[model samples]
Target: MKELAGQTALVTGGTAGIGLESARLLARHGATVIITGRSQQRGEAAVAELGAGVRFVAADLADLESVQALVRHCGDQVDIVVNNAASFPGALTVEQDVTSFESTFDTNVRGAYFLVAALAPAMLRRGHGSIVNVTSMVAFKGVPGASSYSASKAALESLTRSWAAEFGPHGVRVNSVAPGPTATAGVTAEWGDVNDELGRALPLGRTAQAAEIAEAVLFLASPRSSFVTGSTLHADGGGVAA
Candidate 1:
């Protein structure tokens, strides 16, 4: 789909896991891709792995300063933006205080929410663009032990809705791709051995590959989904339904 041949994209948390896979697909489909990650070496390695037509930016989603830096850099050239980067501080582990809750929200919500606020106007000026904010099935179903994570992602979905409503008139579409139990490095780190059990519980009886979910994002970002503003494409194998 060279439909995006002349376009530019910025994917956050794109050094590994789902972000890397998505970047590959977008670049292959003819979009010049720029991915972000905290690790300089990993970010470079990922760009290298994608071989060509892909670039890298350094940004830590947990740091507002880094987020600003990322936004400024990407503002230089971009038509599409994928807020695919996120962090989970474990489920239900409350700090029982404003500071702790804020710590968690800072990355999952504040960082991403404001990043787009800072960058989307540039898209608006371009007169056309698509923004895909990645959420999770956990945001819909109250996944056990993921209370905080779920709530944060829910906030992201909320941002998607409000932003789309506010910006759609400018020809900027905002949508989301909510993936479930994907095989990514972060999932491996967090879900561990229990991931296999979770997969068995899915209606499809298996977890989806990163590429499968990435493809969904590609569709939403492409003109094919021009009418898809403010909507969420759930690629969870019916996990939320079941």
Candidate 2:
């Protein structure tokens, strides 16, 4: 049987980038994948691209009500939840405002926080589940223009450990995947030709692809990682190592 033959998964911010790829992989493994995004057009497009049996739900993580609505809409008993929704507003500490910090935390930390709260109990009832949070390498390293983004991700990493501890005894696992400079549309738009410049600086001499980061998320969300919990997988092409 396929590893996720009878499972259901919720992947937030899944219309593009790593979230989209992760949802694609999960669905390919026979999981019923439900993806959430803020854009109706993009969500529908992603569902179509992922083929049959995959669903799309509109959600904006910055709104607590939307997050709650998403949970209620997804019904009961999701075997996997990927907290891949996040906002990245880059600003130096001196220039960062309350709005920046709150917005980032609202989406990255608060949304993921309440999501685990909402879905974990049902998972506990089933005595098995997996939660994978997509964080960033800046959470572990200092990035000049991304203070708020980094802090928000750091909070998520901290929650990964806390949730793992709280949910482990109940047979549910919580973990995180931190991606380094990855080749995605968003990144390419922000940092033009970053692969060659940043790639040379990294230990592995290259940036990562969105699919590679998705693979890391897949591992944590699968039974293959049954014994793993409270861990953070760095899919940075050795950026963290360097």
Candidate 3:
């Protein structure tokens, strides 16, 4: 039997990159995976790629109303929720008359927070579940030119601990995965020339593959990790250790 047999999972930001990989891993482990993407087109494409027993939903994290709708649409108690959709609105962007902080927090932190809030009640009633926030090494070591985004991840990390404590007695676990620079399309563009600098400094000497991080997520989300909660798994290629 698959590790995740007889489970149902929801993965946010599942249209691309790490989220896509994580969702696929869960599906392969025998979970019915429902993935979310901002664009309907991309969501449909992602569902197609995931094959049978996999599905998609469209939810733009920046919008609270959309998030609520997405949760309601999620249907039934979910065994796992991978909060993997987030944005890195690099340097100096602003939202709602404030600064980039608002935009960054809205999508990265608030979206995940509210979605979990909506889902947790149902999960708790079911008496078993897991929540995995797709955080970044930036949450701890910090990343330049992405202060707002990093701050958002840091905030989510805090929530992971808090949620773990609050929900543990109910048999729900909340944890995080902080990945280093993975070779995603977005990261490929962000790398330019400085990417190698981090790799050289890292003990592993190279960025992790998306599937590597996805496997870590699967571990944390599985019964295999039932005793582990509130921890941040660093899939950072030793970036922080270096």
Q: Pick by lDDT: which candidate is best?
A: 2
lDDT: worst 10-residue window of model 3: 91-100
Task: Put down candidate 1 lDDT per residue, 1-242, tens digits, no spaces.
Answer: 38889999999889987889889989998999999988999988998899889989888877889888888777657788898888765545553355656776887788888888888888888779999998998899866667777888999999999999999989999998998888777887977766666777899998778989999999999999988899989899998789
Candidate order (TM-score): 2, 1, 3
- Put down candidate 2 lDDT per residue, 160-237, tens digits, no spaces: 999999999999999999998888876677556644566677888888889999999999999999999999999877
Once superposed on the true structure, which residue ranges of model 1 sit more than 4 Å away at CA? Answer: 93-103
Clash pairs, candidate 1, are 91-145
Q: Over the stretch 1-242, how does candidate 3's per-residue lDDT look in tens digits?
A: 99888889999889889999999999998999989887899889888898998988888888999999988888675889999988775563333235556877898998999999988988888889999999998788855666777888999999999999999999999999999878777676755545556656678888778889999999999998989999999999987786
In candidate 2, the residue pairs with backbone N, CA or C atoms under 3 Å apart (3 or more residues apart, or in different chains) clash, namely none
Better of 2 and 3 by lDDT: 2
Candidate 1 versus the native: TM-score? 0.94
lDDT of each: 0.86, 0.91, 0.86
